[model samples]
Target: MTQQSAAATPMSKEMQDCVQACMACHSICEETMSSCLRMGGQAPAQIMGALMDCADITRMCADMMMRRSPLAAEMCAMCARACDLCAEACAAMPDDAQMTRCAEACHRCAESCRAMASAMM
Candidate 1:
């Protein structure tokens, strides 16, 4: 394919970073959610809900980016909001190592997604 062809077009650095961040956030949220569930009474419904929401959104955003969907930008914006909420929930439990890690991942993912969304606009 020629340089100007669609197939020859590479993803911008921000988009690539957002995609990677989304995938990482998905994995972290899933793991954190499972961990919270395993903790039984330690995990509250709100935290669990946030984790689940973050996991699902991140997975969808990553998939959309991978497919080069036209709606990926919107999806990234949604993912950023979800990630921020999830990070806040996780960060509330400061003593837990898993929660802390999940919060950090979520925050980074949110930043990356925000950048991607702005770039796509």
Candidate 2:
């Protein structure tokens, strides 16, 4: 699409990308948490809980964007911050490739969300 056409649109590529990442992160985190649970004591319960929280928030943020909710910008900002912290926590557990991937995904999603939120400002 041409710049003019795209510009006229409310959502930009960055916003779309962020939403996609947020969705992916949500699914991945849920899956990862399940896997961790299956591992029983091997998984950190507190960390898992935090991951679930982050994923839920991330998904909520994406949902707001999909509906073009009035609170989308605020939600995105909050999700971005949550994602960043979650990513950092995941990064600490380098032993699990899933965690690492989730961390990276969250980080990327956070950046995109933040950018989109900034655009709305």
The best candidate in terms of TM-score = 1
Q: Candidate 1 lDDT, tens digit per residue, 1-121?
A: 3424633577778778888999999999999988887888487788999999999999999988876777888999999999999999999899999999999999999999998888877
lDDT of 1 at 81: 97
- TM-score of candidate 1 to 2 decimals: 0.90
Clashing pairs in 1: none
* Clash pairs (backbone) in predicted model 2: none
Reference-based TM-score of each model: 0.90, 0.85
RMSD versus native structure for model 1: 2.9
Give a tens-digit lDDT track for model 2, residues 1-121: 5645544668767778888988998987787788787878476666687688888998899888876776888998998888888888788789999888888888888888899889867
User: Model 1: residues >4 Å from true position, as ranges?
Assistant: 1-8
Give candidates' CA RMSD values in order: 2.9, 4.7
